[model samples]
Target: MPVAAFAVVAGVIGAGPVIAAVQGDPALPERTAGQLLADAAQASRSGLKPMSGTVMQTASFGLPGLPEVQGGMGGASPTALLVGSHELKVWYGGESKLRLALPGRMSETDLIVNGDQVWLWESEANKATRVKVDAGAHEKAGGHPKPEEALPTAVTPQQLAQQVLQAAEADTVVSVTNTERVADRAAYQLVLAPKDASSLVKEVKLALDGETFVPLRIQVYAKSSAEPAFEVGFTSVTFSPPAAENFTFTPPAGAKVEEKSLGTLVGEHGADRGEGADPTHGRFEDGELKGKIRTVGDGWTTVAVLPVSERDLRTPDTGGQRGQDAGAIADTILKSAKPISGAWGSGKVIQTKLVSALLTDDGRLLVGAVTPEKLAEAAGRK
Candidate 1:
């Protein structure tokens, strides 16, 4: 997980946007915080009816002095979300199998819930577990179980209104800007700022549909920061009932069963699937190979090749130790291995197991290797 975090950081830093679109007028008129919140809450409740649609989710992390890190895990490559009473479903590929929150536990693996019982399946672990949920358990897990931790962060139209109203009650002003188009529907822009600076959320902005009152966009800003730390934009949505099987869960035959907390599973899986830093670039020199490199996984070494405009990195003839002299091939491999920053410290270091040079689909040269401690550091009982 730590290695993945580092790689994500590198990716985010490498990608940055210079311009941002203005959705609502900042000088829009103000309304009583209560009225705005009430309207928002009402809209949320009414829109909660059985519905199904696609939803896309992405998470980005930013730190001081470093570039931002962004990653997305969703069933819809770019979008997926479903709404319904009998069955609700959402999927984010590569991030998690499926998620279900029942009373007292949250499962990010595959899950199926029927009235009083919930079934969970973990394909990677080849295990299926069942649990009975009651009213008490629901309350303990926060009224209702959600698939992912990010779900709670999303505010429905009604929830947005209620939150705006609550902020108003606290003497915070709620301002509703002019209606604007989002996903082809007119939406009311609402902004709420706290009267005190010590509040958990400094400010929240929401875009609610004019007719359905569904939330189209949400932005959250930190107390002392000017930029939004988190943002969710709905590209598409629907209000149709989901399929009956959407909520059904059945374990495959011969699967193992066990009792465990959701937190335990998340911690365990996160470490196992975590990524590492980006590889450094280098080349062969003299009888040795030298270049920038980073350690990943357990005993895995990764080398990044600098983009060369004149050279094609993907030719098969470029690889294979058989063609090159032993000394030249060894030197080429060693020369390409350079130290990577922030991948190691006094207590941790990356080790290489094997090295393979290949070309990416886009014709870029890539070297894949294993790190020794990478897996050990990321895998353990939560």
Candidate 2:
């Protein structure tokens, strides 16, 4: 699908009022579960019209609180999204022109993707990084012209909705719960409940815009809680295309600018090389653990096993203060992980409301939405 442009923005710590579920419910025409699913799938494949909106994400993982990092980088850092409530402003003018602004108390971070050029500017640090995407290379990877393939992984509501829908066909019961009004637009609530009791996720709810069939909100509920452990949605939205100027970016005069390219980011491998390739033969590069990444089982019970060597766990001398900060955070998380052992050997297991992870002494890390026992079963496999 052409969803590569949907994840440029991420969550940030902030506060906002709860958007009402509408006074009662919008009087929208009834849509059968199958029809809604088919329409949503088609909408995702076709992509959405140019639009702009404010997004809100809240996470309550039921795990120990993560220590907040200091400085301008902290606001946009991945850790910030794990807990608390946050918001981001997004402008999408087709796949080639997009913008994401994450606001903080004293500074702001913006990511602008215009044409083949992408800019990441941080106000707090007065730094900017410009990435040049080769259109030919991007096209080889996927028909979608997205430069985010060169960046770290991130999940958006629309992207998550599609993934959940794919997994739902095999292991979930899909139904239309009711009508909802999201982002001031009428929507249909489609709920997918897991058929496997061993899975930690109770259900996933998606609110699809009645007119466009675009996913406006996504909520994931855990088996132990009635409330969603993770929820993301638009607070306000307009389907009209944003101004062209919104995608243009110019770094501050005094900001340090670093230039990069898609080839430099992904190494010698062509962007198209990884499709259906054996991840076990993948190579590690640029701080990413590539090799030894593989999945077990199928559907909602799938377990992804990643390798983490002793060197990978140690604090690196590079990246200066940021590296130290990241190492400290990893240490804290490891300290909080529960020690576990079995016929599968010894390791630490981190259990959240909807996910479970086992970091083995043998350097293998098994993670999935299934129970810890399920992880152990996968571990015991050859």
Candidate 3:
């Protein structure tokens, strides 16, 4: 879903009282949740305007069972900013991608769809893949089922405000505190606790610009836990209209292209695994796990996966280019693979990385560094 706009923070119990004091009016029109949300949504719709600016985001999360293994998987700790109508630049995945002209290079995770087909560019490997937008598989894969339909012109501040409002509508509250500044504009801060204590998200604090009513920051806390599930922040914003050509793309000559029915790389990757293995059952150590490994373009393939027992999870071996520092990389991956409890209980994909994939016996596809220790821990070895 549109890459959850921002990560939220938890354990903000004292924040409400502190924010109320900063607002300078303890009794200032205690707005009901509904009234406040409506006003925010209205403000957002009215504030729609063409603009452009930069944004810098930093997000960090800990692992599922091993909190000690922190900071393992995200690209760069803090994302650099240089986005606008004509260009969008990002430093991630140990590389950089810049979109300055039509048919230019793009990051592997970058998605560009124009006309009837969607184009995915992997600048690191210098390859591009294409999938028809009207593919029926996209309907099942959570993408725009029909590209021919009229698409929203842009993601406006108003649309963001509406999302926040929808969340607020479910839980009624008596008071909200407005503080903090985003994009050099005033923002409203709200502290909310889930009505149901068992919810995955314990508490959420949102910062919405007072004038524009757009979301500036969001922090999500795991219930009964002081640690945050994830956190995201926004800055350097411009509302200028993007150029028509910004969304279009044309494959380069001699570029290797593959057709897929799914909308996202994750789905495509999963489908590949399913097709290569027996649907009834599969083993982690068997040769069924083997698959073709190639760089997006001309780079050499440098990732692999091997089976490991529970003891292997605790044992660290010195080999290959260590992903960042061991502790940091472990933390990043764990946090992204937070656990889920239910019938379908499979963990969620917090973030996708450009690396190798591991198909486990239990139907889990672990992606990223395929180190013995990393895979062991991810596969619940210990």
Q: Per-prediction TM-score, please? A: 0.39, 0.73, 0.43
Candidate No. with top lDDT = 2
Rank order by TM-score, top first?
A: 2, 3, 1
Q: Per-residue lDDT for 1-382 in model 2, tens only?
A: 1132122211100001111132234467776554554565556556678999999989998876665554433245456667879888999999789899988778887889998779878787787888887768756777753433422332553443344333333456665645588999888886656677788988777778888877788888999999999988899999899998999988878899988785674452222222112222223544366554789987668899887643455444335444555566667767778887899898888789999988888988798998988998898885
Candidate 3 lDDT tens digits, 1-382? 0012321121122112212223444323444443444554444344334443444333333323322221111111111111111223321111111222221223333466444646666554456777555456545667643221122222653443344444343332224665466667666666566443223445566766565555666655654357544545455554445555556677677776776654465564433322212121233224443553222211011223344222222222323223223334344444544344333334434332213344443445444422323433444532
- Every candidate's lDDT: 0.38, 0.67, 0.39
Which is the leading candidate under TM-score? 2
Task: Give the runs in model 2 whose Cα sits over 4 Å from its true position.
Answer: 1-26, 70-75, 113-121, 126-170, 248-283, 286-291, 309-319
Higher-lDDT candidate of 2 and 3: 2
Q: What is the lDDT of residue 60 in candidate 2?
A: 92
Candidate 2 Cα RMSD after full superposition onto the native fold (Å): 8.6
lDDT of 2: 0.67
Decide which is better by lDDT, 1 or 2. Answer: 2
TM-score of 2: 0.73
The better-scoring model by TM-score among 2 and 3 is 2
